[model samples]
Target: MKQHLFHGYMTKNVQKRISEATTAILPSEREMNSGINKARRAMTPTIPTTQLFDIAEPFTKTLHDDDFLIVDKMITRRQRILLFASREQLKMLLGVDTILMDGTFSTCPSVFDQVYTIHAVKYDQSFPCVFGLLPNRLKTTYHFMFQELKSVAMQMQ
Candidate 1:
């Protein structure tokens, strides 16, 4: 597409050939994305902030009564609570020796930062045992999460 008075013009064929012959790859180069957007589009339309909290109300209701579920707002930003683990999920996590942790930002909505998952091997297979939405990737935030989970695990034993 570059044009100069002395060089004239570059045709479509020339551009195509140039792109095809190039071997240099950028650091951020990624494969063409296709199916990734479909699931996001299929989801229910984005809910309002109030509704988002309302959706989580039932889960928070258990925080006071349930000894297993750990929900703490001070651990993260913007009142975005750090949900450590549910009773059943904690039980599963306690039973597993090898644990895996991963963070996914692509599927996370604008309401939160990233979906942090803690997985464990059970019955010779890996399963996502607990999920949490972190507001920021701070060392303190992660420490709080692991510390809470460790305390809960100790209580279970």
Candidate 2:
């Protein structure tokens, strides 16, 4: 099978193309899906079962241009928080006086309880500056996030 077909297309699309290319009997959709899943698992790095998994190398930077993406990673007594922002984003955030902060719970990964975002208003437009994956909504969590962001921003100036 051509490897490129498996790279970005959906499973069903790959399966259909593969089936059409050959005359031999093909595996059922369920079996093909299971095999595809197994292949994906084998290629991916193993993640810690607990919440303490280290960010893998592939995820540490931006994919297209390879710019640094992680601003901070903090582990407290109750939770682990990962803050993601580019240096330019941080500078924009620090430049503005009126910033907006919002916390969302529904779209976060299972390992995190919330996704907190900081937005900077520039010329009446709000641009997201920082994305934080937090474990809980405690006051200390917010404090830690803000303190770390401030530290990063200070160092950049």
Candidate 3:
């Protein structure tokens, strides 16, 4: 398999190839994921808690363009919110008349309580304009998020 598949290929792609080669035996997706995660953890360096607040340069920008960080602010003494959106996304958000917002608590990082997202509808399609990792689901937190976004939008205009 090593001779055929490239090094650093995704676990899922490797699993698929292996399954195709050996039709009778198949590894469960969860097992493959576990193995991959274990390997990754062993290879990656651990970061201190203090350094988590300082986002690295590579992560501070969008993949295809310039900076993506829209806002990084503390709404309260203990709560910090990190908002990300590309300039194009912000422009689309500003041009649209209708926007939708939702918050999910399950998939956010351990330090954040919820992942709040804002979407704008234009030409019958919805585009996610902003993604925010919020500390809590309080009304004040939401208010602050909106205010920060509004302030950025105002500056853009």
Candidate 4:
């Protein structure tokens, strides 16, 4: 058996794999609740020798869930802090009562990595908190993810 390494870039194949994996996990498109483990498929086989901390667009899966939820992406240190900062600001403005807690999480189980820049949000009066960790590595991908998230959050607001 050979273990495939993951890459930072999000390519066409990556999307396909992510969709496949997600569908395999949630075949009925049922509501994904807390403590629900998703899928983990290698998007990139090999990391670039020289690369920036930018992850390709379209992300891996669709983020159509707006219910009380927490999402943790495997990002890096820079991304952790920056993303936290951005979300924190937005939460304050939106009066969402969001918190940037310290913890570790992953989309895939058996991975001991913990995400630092964790965000907790409960939009409606439904769930208590929307909690999740960021990506694992503190590589450039983290920075890029944070920047992109911050940018998007800014534009959305």
Candidate 5:
């Protein structure tokens, strides 16, 4: 019989400890989210900020594109961790059901309509994982992404 590293499901104390650790490691809610209500404050994606605005038409104007799609692996295993942080941050900023449909500005919330859209960066799985408090996936993924990015940089040079 081996001792388990974690429980089958988190206990209340475990959840509390983890939450406190996360708060310390990340930031206080006020510190983590200190810009949403401000006028025209923006975030660089890496830093958590507040700017809950429309999701659809703005994408076209900002990206200068008319067509787009978002796809991803189902939330499970490591994805659960990733989606938790990403979606939590997004919710802190943009609320839960804010992203647009068809990239043409239609509102939908049909379970599959606009749900679980979380990513450390753009929902590019190949872009590298960003699962915090994970099984150290971020470190390895960052290492691989670094190599890939370096290769592209060399090609440009």
Candidate 6:
């Protein structure tokens, strides 16, 4: 198909050589993926870690309402964002004693590390109460998550 696209541009000899080379050694899937990854890495722009907070600041500010709800958020130096629950969600979380925490990597974006979630359980059902994008599964990150939660909970009161 590509050869056809460049049909008139290439000489007959050049076309024959390219065709023979392609047929003689077809690239494996791994080789194709390696080239694709290389191209993507080259094209992808690198954002400074500190600048990440600046980029998200506007979006986080918009999450708030007139009731002062949706105002709780934690952002680390590495740009890990732990978006806490709203006033109503926080109330529900307080009602439950056994909260669950889980990290989902498959849904995580390449920009961050993982999607760490907090769940509140009631009546044998688990409800996701909070969401965070962490740079890694570091102890400090997890500590920040809880510290932010406590700070936010106090604010809700």
Model 6, 1-157: lDDT tens per residue?
A: 5976675556455556777767558676579779999998887555544425343433443256423224234454545554645566678888998999899898877766788877899999998877777777788878877787788788767
What's model 1's lDDT at 136? Answer: 70
Best candidate, lDDT:
3
The number of clashing residue pairs in model 2 is 0
* Model 5 quality (TM-score): 0.17
| Higher-lDDT candidate of 2 and 6 | 2
- After superposing candidate 2, which stretches have Cα over 4 Å from the reference? 1-48, 63-74
Best by TM-score: 3
67-95, model 1: which lDDT tens digit per residue? 33365555523546456566777788887
lDDT of 2 by residue, 81-141 (tens): 8888877788898889899999999998887889999999999999998888888999888
Q: Arrange candidates, best lDDT first.
A: 3, 2, 6, 1, 4, 5
Model 5, stretches more than 4 Å misplaced?
1-138
lDDT of each: 0.65, 0.79, 0.83, 0.41, 0.31, 0.67
Instruction: Compute the lDDT of residue 137 as modeled in candidate 6.
Output: 76
| TM-score, per-candidate, Cα-based | 0.55, 0.66, 0.69, 0.28, 0.17, 0.55
Better of 2 and 4 by lDDT: 2
| Global local distance difference test of model 3 | 0.83
**Which parts of model 1 have CA positions greater than 4 angstroms off?**
1-69, 76-79
Q: Which should have the higher TM-score, number 1 or number 4?
A: 1
- C-alpha-based local distance difference test score of model 6: 0.67
lDDT of 6 at 28: 66
lDDT of 4 at 38: 35
Prediction 3 TM-score vs. true: 0.69
In candidate 4, residue 117 scores what lDDT? 44
Which pairs of residues collide in model 5? Answer: none
Least lDDT summed over 10 consecutive residues: which range in candidate 3? 44-53
- lDDT score of residue 40 within candidate 5: 40
